[model samples]
Target: MGESLFTKVWNMHKVKTLSSGQDQLFIGLHLIHEVTSPQAFAMLKERGVKVLHPERTFATVDHIVPTKNRQRPFQDELAEKMLAALESNTTDYKISFFNLSTAYQGIVHIIGPELGLTQPGMTIACGDSHTATHGAFGAIAFGIGTSQVRDILATQTMAMNKSKVRRINVSGKLQKGVYAKDVILKIIEVLGVKGGIGYAYEYGGEVIENFTMEERMTVCNMSIEGGARFGYINPDQKTFDYLKGRKFAPQGEAFNRAIRFWKSLASDPDTHYDDVVNIDVSDMAPMITWGIHPGHALEVSKSIPALNRFSVDEKATAQKALEHMQLKEGQSLLGQKISVAFIGSCTNGRISDLREAAQFIKGKKVHKDVFAFVVPGSVQVKKQAEEEGLDKIFEAAGFSWRGAGCSICLGMNDDQLVGDQVCASSSNRNYIGRQGSPTGRTLLMSPAMVAAAAVKGELVDLREVI
Candidate 1:
């Protein structure tokens, strides 16, 4: 019997099995951000500890970087403090950091893959929940907490219980307007939010196999929403192509040798999995989350689910999301007014996402009542979008082309929701108060969907707009 990719990576990185039965896994790459590392660094400082492998850790500022006007001594005092702390910590600890002024700087997840730091058969860790995004490269990636971050920094290894592999195969062809974002959303809807507990999801089949690296990242990025600590696609030709010319990737003859190893890291054809779930790609639609949780979603053409339709445990959660959103049950998601439209985040902030949105908004004007913006995931993505004229299309359509950062993805930055505004956002998470307003409503969808909504000034089917 052949080994799965998860097992291959896990066995290679496992240091030893602890008495508690957890494996002390050595992390090949550790990504960090300002929001989660401040306290962890402080803990290390107090304990007189030094990073065991500072070269393995990379840091960047994203969550709290002001998108509009990124001047030093930022308007937000707390954000300024966090930025200063990260700068000081990284400098003092001799860790590599992508500062705001660096062209490489952006969301931790976005920068890691773009630089080819994420590789097959690697154990990757980060403090953000969406760190699973790197799993698209066939690595075992998981989100670690602050304490674990400290442990990784101090010892280069962290203890973790093993996760069973659940192979999710999506076959058939995806219809027009149904994107990678929609595919993952449909999976979450079918499997429910907590379906993959204690499992590492392995995505395969025709649909996943045919997807581009960026598309795979979009799908793997949201595995956390499905209750999976990690999710991945087996490495293939597409993966090798994306990493070939990257800055951190090996060069020339060495690159060919690396590709050979990368190819070998793929799961064998007959690898066994603990469980298998199949999905039909033809049934997926352009999906959006109508409620607080990413799983509380419906197709743009569908109506909001009624409270009575939910289980008793889900009823309370649904009602709370409705109350915070100021929405009624069975309401039509179509034509629901939107105050803001955001097209950036670690989840959907790549150059590909910008191009997709620009294609739909090319000649159309944004609705007068809507405030829409396109914030790229990284400085590199921003430069490429400009080179491709996507930035012009967005700007001509009345969408503000802002600097890169986690703009409006969360409430930490200057970009925020005012009053009880309802935002159509491409960023992950639609949790209440996530967009800087306690009562602000967030409808999570793809970058293209957000652009379409901006033009219509409401929720509209992307198929019609496209």
Candidate 2:
């Protein structure tokens, strides 16, 4: 039997077997952001170590930067300190840094792909959980903790245990209003949150193959929510096309050679897998998380699951989510009042996501009670949106157009939710206290869905709005 792409890439990057019985894998690309790298860089200085491969590493600020007023010496003292540390450390280590002034600056995940630093047949690691977002390019990418961040920076390699591979085949054509976000939510809902433990998810089938690079990024961005350490789709034409003119990608004749190599990185037709899952896109609807956990979601038209409806093992968790969300059993997710609508994050902060939301909300006003905002993924995305008049559409609809950063996504910056105020968020997580306030409720949905909810002041169907 042929080997899966996971095994193929893992073996290709293996440096050595460590005494601890783990594979010492060399990371082809290392992505760093402000929040997690400060401590790691401090540790490196204390130990008198330099970044082994500065060329392979890239740095940017996102997690804690305020999107509204981004002047030097940030208003948040801690954020200012982190930014200073990152700037000094990157300069000392000779690593390329995407500071705020640079047009390339954005969320680490978004910056990596848009710059083409993320490519097929490579290993990618970042200090952010959504680092899996790079897997859209058919690379093996996953999140690393602070300590592991230090490890990669010091030696350019980290030890990891092997994981089983599971093939998630999504077939058929997606209906209108259904999106990549919906498809991923459906996968998590069917497979449960922890179904991917000890496994690497390999997404394939007609629907996946047909997805644009942005859509694939959306699917791979939430692999961690499904308990997968990593996720990827095999490289294809879309992958090559996206990388063709990227700054880091090969140029001239080198480009042709790179495509040949990338094409070979795809998994063989008869590749073996530990497990397989199939989903039909035709039956899918736009999804929203009605509770804390990402898997605790339902279709817009469906009601919240009762405690008894879940497996006995899941009842306690389900009940907790329902209670924290202030939702009752069997109550429909529709008609939930939202106080805020956020349209940017690594998960859905790409230019395409912004345009999609703008397309539906143009000329429509936000609900009187809803406070809405649109944050581009990077300065580049912000500029592009302005060029296409997307910024005007949002601002005209009363959606505050803020600067780039991880604004309102993980809520480390000034952007946050107030007590018990529900938010229609395009960010990754919907966990309790994830949006800053301890009692803030976040409902994860596509940017367009979030806009619809903001307009209707409820979880209205995207089909109705579009």
In order, what is each prediction's RMSD in angstroms?
1.2, 0.9
Residue 78 of model 2, lDDT score: 86
Over 270-374, each residue of candidate 1 has an lDDT whose tens digit, in order, gives 998999998897756799998889889888788888789998868998998888887899998888899999999989999899999999999999999999999
When summed lDDT is taken over every stretch of 10 residues in candidate 1, the lowest stretch is: 278-287
> Model 2, 1-466: lDDT tens per residue?
8888889899999999999999999999999988888899889889999889999999999988898899988888989999998999899999999999898999898889989899998899998888888999999999999999999999999999989999999998887888899999989999889999999999999999999999999999999999998999999998998998988988999999988888888888888899999888786778999888999877887888767789988898888998899989999987888989999998899999998999999889999999999989998899999999999999999999999999887889999998889999998899999999999999999999999999998888888767
User: lDDT at 403 for candidate 1?
Assistant: 88
User: Which pairs of residues collide in model 1?
Assistant: none
lDDT of each: 0.91, 0.91
**Over 4 Å off, model 1:** none
